[model samples]
Target: MITVERLTKRYGPFTAVDDVSFEVKPGLVTGFLGPNGAGKTTAMRVMAGLTPATSGRATVLGKPYAALPNPGRHVGLLLDASAQHAGRTGREVLTLGAILMGVGKHRVDEMVELVGLTEKEANRRVRNYSLGMRQRLGIAHALLGDPEVLILDEPANGLDPAGIRWMRDLLRGYANEGGTVLLSSHLLNEIERVADEIIVIGHGKIVAQGTKDELLAGAGTYTRSTDDEALMAALAEASIVAQRTPTGGLQVEAEPIAVGRVALAHQIVLTELRGADSRGLEEMFLDLTAGAAREEVAA
Candidate 1:
């Protein structure tokens, strides 16, 4: 439902988003990930029609977002929760959005409830609301139109643990019902929980794009052994290489059970044996962008 083809955005001489290409299809949540300087937000902004791309295109349903006749009904966006007017009540904010989207005012109440805001809380001014409350309000506004596509940037920000889980289920359910989502976030664990596919960007370029399983197929178990040297040798003899983590742990290129069998065969004792889970995405992300120039990996 969303497509970016060779999308680029430049500020002065610096490129914020390089020639990037990807797609977010119906019934899928694509996680956009990167480090501090990566162009995740910039790319998303372009997709949302909040910023002009330097070259190439970002489109929804084969057209740029600006070309949509009823963009609010075609795409729901929550780029900045703090962008809401402080003087407006939570209900007022969603009401205004509903009006602009040409939807019924009753949507305001429905969304307020959907986002877990009580009527009293919705009647309160946004300035008096907590950051989490503001986030909830923003989400309610985003859903006011019930758009086919959702473009959320850090939607989980300022949300408590339960709120985060609520958002995960909400988006998961949306996608299950054939909605498309493209979201950017620093919360890797949250992304791991809800994202079907991942797009990792660094230096404004896409370093990797794949399903969680496909990208993580190469990621192995994170392990620590009592006999580090012997464990390393056994792994080496088995033609398996282990990556050393900064925390002094080992990430072996094999499953924990396989690593354990090798350790036992070599009389090595393990102090830690855990599957390389969503946590491995961090390492994979770093490995993909380890150089000044990175080769893109797609699966």
Candidate 2:
């Protein structure tokens, strides 16, 4: 398990991670989510001991990561996929990692194949590998030690749809076999499909953290009626708050049954009524991180 308690990191006058706290339980995949500059990477770096925290602590398996013996064998980390040496081949990278982690050379081959890199591709220099191939190689290196816990940052950055699906299944299978995974990625849909729990960070602070079901339970109910305005008015009269969805549906802040009764009392014909969870993680993520989102502009 991974535990971060009130961790904070600062640079000069700027604070990157602010009093953040969260726990990643064993046998589960926890998705770390944040907009650009929200400190997700900084928090993960602290967990891996790459950066010293200004205050607080982060531990993996009940100990600071650096304190673990042959750390890679217990905690696998892939913070930056493209940080590999350009002079080395993909196979060379894993071989060196295996040596450092005191793992058998045979494990290198297993990981190379497991990540779907062709033998020919593995033999090519890292400089020649595409971003997607680099990601695969990075994943291979992370699993080289067969660690019980994996911390990966943006592992799906350059993967295609099929590759992403493969990654999802691989993480799921790893968790099923009792491995703990903390994955950070911009792919909300993929995270929704793979993660058992989610942590959302904004402005270096944890805005929300919970199991997928627990988070979605607060999404309330989605209702559509033949007369949306009438349904909206009725909901207001019942002291229930609601907002109009982009699709002209009312996102009622109440149970489906409650909304149904309100509509029935007003003799409004309902066309659809269900939990807003059907809207999925993207909507919830956007809502939680609202002003924290950074808009990108092409130079």
- Which candidate's lDDT is highest? 2
Cα lDDT of model 1 by residue, 1-299, tens digit: 99999998888877889899999999998899876557888888889888899999999978989999889988999888888888989888887788889999888878988998898999999989998998898888888898999998888889888988898899999999999988887656777877989998888888888998877766788888887777888899998888778888787888788898998889888999987876567786666455554322210
Candidate 2 residue lDDT tens string, 1-299 = 99999998987767888899999998999999877677878888899998899999999999999999999899889888899899999999999998988888899889988998899999999999999999999888888888999999989889999998899999999999999999987657767777999997777788888998887777789989999999999999999999998878998888899999999999999999998863545675677557746432110
- Kindly give the stretch of ten consecutive residues in candidate 2 with the minimal lDDT sum: 290-299
Q: CA shift at 267, candidate 2, in angstroms?
A: 7.6
Enumerate residue pairs that collide in model 1.
none
Q: What lDDT score goes with residue 142 in model 1?
A: 80
lDDT of each: 0.84, 0.87
Give lDDT: candidate 1, residue 208.
82
User: Looking at model 1, which ten-residue stretch has the lowest summed lDDT?
Assistant: 290-299
lDDT for predicted candidate 2 compared with the true structure: 0.87
Model 1 ranges with Cα > 4 A deviation: 223-234, 243-250, 256-274, 278-280, 284-299
